[model samples]
Target chain A: MARGSTRPTSRDVAQAAGVSQAAVSLVLGDKWRGRVSQATAERVREAARDLGYRPNLAARNLRLGRTRTVLLVVPALTTEFFAGVYTGAARIAAEHGFGVVLYPSPEGIGPARDPFASAQSALDGVIASSMAADALTAIRGEALPLVMLDSDPDGSLGAATVNLDIADGIRQAAEHLLSLGHRRFLHLAADVPSWTFEVRARELAARLDEVPGTTVRTARSPISIEGAVTAAQAALAAPGDRPTAVICDDDQLAAGTYKAARRLGLRIPDDLSVTGVDDLALATAMDPELTTVHLNAELFGERGMRALLAVLEGRAPESGDIPVRLVLRGSTARAG
Target chain B: MARGSTRPTSRDVAQAAGVSQAAVSLVLGDKWRGRVSQATAERVREAARDLGYRPNLAARNLRLGRTRTVLLVVPALTTEFFAGVYTGAARIAAEHGFGVVLYPSPEGIGPARDPFASAQSALDGVIASSMAADALTAIRGEALPLVMLDSDPDGSLGAATVNLDIADGIRQAAEHLLSLGHRRFLHLAADVPSWTFEVRARELAARLDEVPGTTVRTARSPISIEGAVTAAQAALAAPGDRPTAVICDDDQLAAGTYKAARRLGLRIPDDLSVTGVDDLALATAMDPELTTVHLNAELFGERGMRALLAVLEGRAPESGDIPVRLVLRGSTARAG
Candidate 1:
């Protein structure tokens, strides 16, 4: 399979199907709605599949004058959260004959200063995730097909938006925690000012406001375990009805909360309840496994890639917000 | 920068530098030695740099009839270690005006599957990391320039080999534990049969064997926190003075050891001492923080890329293993 010879091309598919090369192109191009009959189109698709006829990206790029490579602009690739998103997106991009190139917008160097000059070469579109809208001004130029993932759908700056059902996920978390008879709550929210986090803040507030006597306090951490520990420790030490339930922005934050509780002589799900988002590998690694929202990072990436592919083909994205679910584990329980 | 005009070429650089186009090409092409005088070459380079010139990758590929892109064959991209290698290699390649395209071997997907079928491009070379040499027979047919990262340099396949100073790193770790009066050690080794982990096992055993009264225990885990916890717990529970120190192959494994110690009523740097490698963010997140070896991921990437570039340009790479150092945090102390 790894021999140096070039792969069988679309022309090979045309010959195998005994159809005109143009017919093969039109059917495989997904542009034969009225030009070719449905039955004939299906024949071309079957033949292409049987012959294992992959498209020649170089030739198609030359003909169309646009490389089908989408630049996925992410904040960082070091974490499992973002890496999962990248994995999902790359898989989907691969399925549809498009290449996904990553641009981790210049950590310590900032995106505007050193965007991948090579990434700009022959890019068909871009999908930016968890980035400041203004930070994307460079990519937003020339009305490139842009899809924002997990960013503000309402306030996206000239880009199509695809997002997890984050507000609903928060609602689910609130319901799960509250159903356990917890009232006093501490939201271990991320200190970031991004819109996705804002959704968590607003949704948690709104959901808690429904119950009279429910109190919500907040602590901000820089989305790391140590940061979450320091912030959560101070938040839990405050003089008030101690929050029985703690909901964190991500699994790493949850791990920090675990440390904070240990220092304060509080035990998870017994003395203090905790929940986390982004069910990263860190969740189960905790002494008492963290209860967290399972944000399908790979699915998120896949959906983002699908949306970009939609934009590239001049078609609308297929559906609504991608689904997310809560995975209840060892970290939450009834009010004391 | 997105001006929709043909980017300034080498001809433009020659005019700007007030030199013949051939002189500019010779200097900018990194072939200035003996072909052009030092002063003239410096002037040409400065002019090209000031203009933010990039040699057109497409045109060069056409002229050479080979893509300047090198295919990186790895087992998977979902792994942090491999991702780190990719980051390291890509950074170095960018500096030398080469591109890296990843070709993750689809394990369990059978030999009928070839990565190049989907990637659909020819390459100037290949740099393989963490792949079985025997399984790479199909890939060996290309006769392309090749560099191996973290592969065995002895039964090797590539033209050049680059690796982290793993053996030395393990020695430093063992010596640190020994100096701290830790005679009984538990090696929380990764179950993967890769050469890198083998180096860790071999080096640690060798170092400890040299120290009188040293005792070593071994456990194999699947490189996940849960797997590490199970393996470490079983190992720690076994007899022989109940080893007070644990040396893990990676940061994630160290984290698991932390939980296992806590479960076994041991505290960090107190009843049990722990150490790890690859200083992941998890190291700093734990309550006591973790002491680990700082394998410079970016530098590793930069070196691999530089090596690939050198091979591409017919130059010699910087020799020897990239060194690693111990980042002592709060995870380990004297065996009490």
Candidate 2:
């Protein structure tokens, strides 16, 4: 029992407590209520604590055919939105005696590495974001249970899907802008070809199509403030009737649009109106607080983990998309 | 092998290749240079691929007393800084046939959970951020190779430390502001009681003390835009002569300072000047791009992982701090 020599085993605890190995197993496993006396169980527990005994979980999990660990695959962790997602997912995972490992697939760097090889843990299940589709081929090679978040339900190869109601959120944004007397519009789309971004484009177009004299021009940019600024500035300065409203793919894009507006001497809500999705901290930090769709990232992550857990347990995952809301702020007003 | 029946074992691969189990082991373990013929090794590899056989890394690693995996413990994943760190660490780890699992210790949520219990992997070592001090007690209980990132080298209990040259960065910032002829200053400090933030405060105070006719005040705020707005506004509105310059602990606080200045009808660089640390993307997004310190977060992470690897190999870690730079942007100017 010398410090740092080796981890004490259950047998060491039993020897220290003067109890049989079987009694130690039963008590430590929490299944000794009927067989072992209360006093003996307490003594065994005390011995284990005194010896700093820790069960070899890796060996035990291998024998049990479960690792009690899942992999949460994300596109990248560069923004607080995904961080919120991981936080919510990890909280739920801890409650269920499961640990969540993150695998952020390399973005446009190269072919995706096998997550199982990279995670180095025998995973019971996987929860993946659709934005990380580059890693799907490698993941599909394995026969583990999986749940897709922010994915197209009809295209996930029969995997359960947990998605925020992004289409509905887009509809709400469009309705709010249309009600504010906006007609000319510029859609600052994320250049990534993910199903979630596709939904944003599709829903916005559909909602705008319902109104007459509504014209929407599309500009694609990488999901970054710098990239958005370049794309937005070019589109806004094009030789034509300038769009009075800009609907950004996300808050970062909206922040860039604000910069673009500044360069063009267009004041927010006075000369132009802007709206964005995913009310990240940057949303409020803008000169005029962004009018954005507040998609609860933590709740999205919670539902994703819950769906993954259900899939692993041989049960049907909950159906229906999580709802989102439009938050009106200074960034939007009657079109000038 | 039938699809989804069971994972094909090395034995199945040997049988399919018509070779002895020992030959398969030598070939797959990459120890067959002299023992097995090249043709036979190629045949065995093809059989493994054809049968979809994967080595049981968990069981093999258990027997070898190594998991080829490490844990990265951070305070939170809510910022791009830590995300950059993880990316760098993971890149190095992958190159060495190792995997990294992140454990963002619960922030202010209660007692810390043992990362070993939650990661559920037999980790070979750990790379921890000092901001996550709450988890240090749990980590210290286990005997493992440890590396500290952004920690006080003198106070890490003998753990190897990797840090940015925060003190030098602060000196440069202070010199820049002082050269602009600022005589009064306000330090907008992060409320977190971590060694890195402490370094900023100490270095800034030490630098400003050398100059005559200079006075400074301090205000504390949580490292968020909203919290900074409240803190900066009150500090700026104090009854005494208002400080002509503000130096924030980080970029988020600087963004909040911009808002506070706007609320008080003060123009940046004209009515007041500002400086910050951590030149995040938000720095350039601000109307007047922030003058701040640029800490290479990815390099810090890479160095941390390299140090942990060196410790695991019983070698001395690389010494010296990673360098940082002061980026001059539009946020600062000569006091008006």
Candidate 3:
């Protein structure tokens, strides 16, 4: 019960139980079913319990040369979507008797930094979100089995990749607004320099270009509500005609547009229609529930971890983009 | 680079540099300045670079008996507030040459479980949120230096406790509503069984008892906005005179109240006014910005990690409740 002291060692437990250290290890490791007698095992267990002996993971990790732990490198944990990814990854890891360590990459777009210095846990592999691509080079240098999430498949440098079919989701959102007799559009995009945000811009442009007489104006901001509000208000306040519909890259951006609209004395759906991707809880929390695309965040995390496991086992990774769906809600309506 | 293969070892680097393995270790471990020749150190560095060698953290941890890593256990990672906590903890950990490993305790209130198995990182200590109290006993068994965040100080069982002044926050919120001439109150509380929520309920009750002719009703729900909407709507659907002011434990619950009011054809600040704690981005994102108490989540995290470091150093933790503030916004107005 002394503070700042290390946990009791197996040797201490062995001494307490009147057994050898090997017998204590064998019993504690659950490998003594046949090697050691049940009575001796029970004695070791009792002594371990009485002494509060906990195995030294550092020693075990050194002996095994593999920790059965994977580091999940993410751009930011504040994003609700990434939280879902962690949930899915952790659940699958637990099922496999493995552990997950989260590394929230330093903010902004830069070369991906190695997580080893910060995680401290020796990792067998890494499953990183594309938003944290800047750190990928450092990760690749470690020669760990790596899986990239939401990255470009063709451009990925031999790492296994998992992606949400985001292009299709953007198309659905653009087409939904286009079908509502809208031509003028505003795309409130996340400013992060990643393939995911790039896809949103490219796909939305291509889809809108196919419809003649359609004009799409764009504004960018960091993915925060305040950032969205400032960028959106400026874009909406620009000198010319205002777009009747706003297509946000994510739900947080959509929420910002709602606040901007209120500031301008405009009503959702009545004056301007809005659409967003990532149907986070904030989507429904909006006064008029958001019309947005639902990307399965947990599924994304699960797939990323699964692909990493496959790579570690020398098996081919499962390839295919996870499908996303569009949910119609109160935020979108016929364009005026 | 071969997939699923171990990283280059010191022996490999030594062979590449035409030096002994001991020389490589001496240079890489930063002991070469005094022992190894400058030429040999340069050779070892170049060889390590060519072979892409990373020091085996597991072996080093085993030898040193200190990993410089700490586990941060929270009830949930998806909450924006907790994300801020992680950021703050990481910042302080970095400054102290330490690492933080996050373990989001499994959902639902069960006996606080040990995170050692899932984190897989050899930790020097732990800083846990009170919301994850179920896992504390298991953590206590490890005899790691422990620091508790937003937990009951008197009940911490010798573990260091750091807390936000939530009682003062609740009091400010209640007194603000009272000053606005509102008597009937609806406490939309998080259903999670944690000392933090208990403090909100207890403090609110104690403060309201000081005022005459005040009626307070309570409703509980999971912290999600949808859950809040459902629970708030159900509670509001009851036939008796409804509470004119709703005080939520967090911003998400306040957002849900916005939706619930819309469902019942009640206008915010007109038919019903609302206030919340945890001034999350969701607070400003609401159509009528929420009136809520701002808890500096990053400060909370920084303080928690600092306490753990103190414990690790056998020093007494800095003791004081972190101050909170109330921001009056559009959600609450003079009661009509």
Candidate 4:
């Protein structure tokens, strides 16, 4: 072995090991299970180690015309939900020798400008949250394989989709409240225009419509604590009989409702009841704890990555929506 | 403009624009500001657009030996603080015609594996949080220019460092509590092994040591509401003169203190007063709100990116710690 300013190459390892360059490539790439003897592979690996030869991945990717890198396009990074998704996706990507680069769109689920340019990596595929559906136009222009998360399967323009059973979760929440003798309801909806939120609204309304005397008032706010506080305060202050039950789009909204209820001198499960989706850490941190839907963000991400991998491999993606469940906590009780 | 199976090249764009290939390159690369006339640049751009010609960034970066991209190595993405940092850093990077890629260390501020391989981009530099200090060893092996965030300036091995004035923030919190006549105190500290957390513990102890009769006890927990609840419960339940005031390392710990107080039939600011650092949304979301130190996370990120850019340009980075302030809410009062 010799050291110099110049880096050693694989050819030098082949020469040192007395093996053909192809044999050296196979051994180093870890694709020589049956093609080369174990002893020969060990010799090649030892020679490469002694010579300090590390393969130039960038150059190899360029030559192979496949970067083996995928981009995960999320709406924003301000929430831990998407962070969980990225963790699960990256875990799967690493297992298959692929890298997942995150691109949190600055436009907040709006039309993302050229993610390829922003990521600065030649990508083999993309896994995008449907909240950022508009970004798909630019992604489609590149003709890269794509998998959409929480998107309407019929409307993804043939892209593979992975979604949680959000409708079922909403149904469970409604049934729980209805069984607790709640009649009047306030639906605190996220103002974002996404298919997932649409499903929540549609499912909640349809479920409530089954009961003849049930009435639900709707209020919209941006998906933020401050925004939810302002919106919930106004709706709770409305005239006539106040809603006995409040169904929030997410845990943040439920947290805000707690504040609003406090301001109105309403007690949880005594004078008012609240429920939320996405049983985040905030749920348990709240005083009464929140009875809400639990969406497995990590599982959603894992499925999304798997679907993309299947698409890239020319195999059919796994079908069926991921399951979600209603977690009963202290926030919900019989209507007062 | 000709439509064909093969994509148009820069030579083809030059022919269509009736200019030399070098002139075409200048216009397309946005480097023709002084070399080419405004009218000629527009004409070349229009011709390229009409022919649907796009420059291949991967090949161009390989040739130039620069990616115009940088990696932001964060300890974790579970908190909104780092999200704010990424947003601010990315805003600055985009203005300078560069891209920022995020690599959240899976090991939670421990040794980060090869970020470049995971990012899958041949980067120009890195901006990292000192919380992820162990990852620096691998980064140093690549010899990429780096800027450390909230790291000890004397121990960064000559790398540029950007930091928040955390010690001063701690001083402010102490003074505010001391002036309120608090003598017995409990410090709910984060259990992370990082320099930032060490500063928090040291500063609190040193400041309390100033008063002749002041006494402070310390308890550590992972930075989560649930973890804080367990640790705070044990500390508050200890047999002794219960501390009238509690200083939390961050808002999440303060939230847990609130729960522990409730569990022990104690009311905030009546039986116990609580203060926290990092006035996150959880601060106001907690009942009675929370008085805390407000660290400017976005400004910290912007400064980190600017320092990295300075290093890349061979310029001296601007020196000074970013300022922080105390936000007074309703969580603290005169010691009972």
Q: Which candidate wins on TM-score?
A: 2
Candidate 2 residue B35 C-alpha distance from true site, Å: 2.0
Task: Please compute DockQ, using alpha carbons, for every candidate against the native two-chain complex.
Answer: 0.20, 0.60, 0.58, 0.45
lDDT at position A97, candidate 4 = 78
lDDT against the true structure, per candidate, is 0.77, 0.90, 0.88, 0.87
Listed in order, each prediction's TM-score against the native is 0.76, 0.98, 0.93, 0.93
Per-residue accuracy of model 2 over B155-224 as CA lDDT, tens digit each: 8899999999999998998999899999899999999879999999999888889988999999999989
> What TM-score does candidate 1 get on C-alpha atoms?
0.76
Evaluated on CA atoms against the true complex, candidate 1 attains a DockQ of 0.20
On DockQ, the stronger of 1 and 2 is: 2
Candidate 1 stretches with Cα past 4 Å from truth are: A1-60, A64-68, A109-116, A132-135, A157-160, A234-242, A261-271, B1-127, B131-140, B212-215, B237-242, B261-271, B333-336
Model 4 over residues B144-220: C-alpha lDDT tens digits?
Answer: 78998988899889999999999999899999999999999999999887778889889989999989999888999
Instruction: Give lDDT: candidate 2, residue B149.
Output: 90
Better of 2 and 3 by DockQ: 2
Off-target runs (Cα >4 Å) in candidate 2 are: A20-22, A107-110, B108-110
Better of 1 and 4 by TM-score: 4
The residue-by-residue lDDT of candidate 1 on A43-101, one tens digit each, is 88898877656565446554565666777777655566766676677677766766666
For candidate 1, lDDT tens digit of each residue in B110-176? 4434455434455667777654443366555545677777768886654688889989989988988
True contacts kept of each: 0.16, 0.57, 0.74, 0.48
Model 4 per-residue lDDT tens digits across residues A37-129: 999999999999988676665567667778888999998776689998998898888878788898887753123557877877778899999
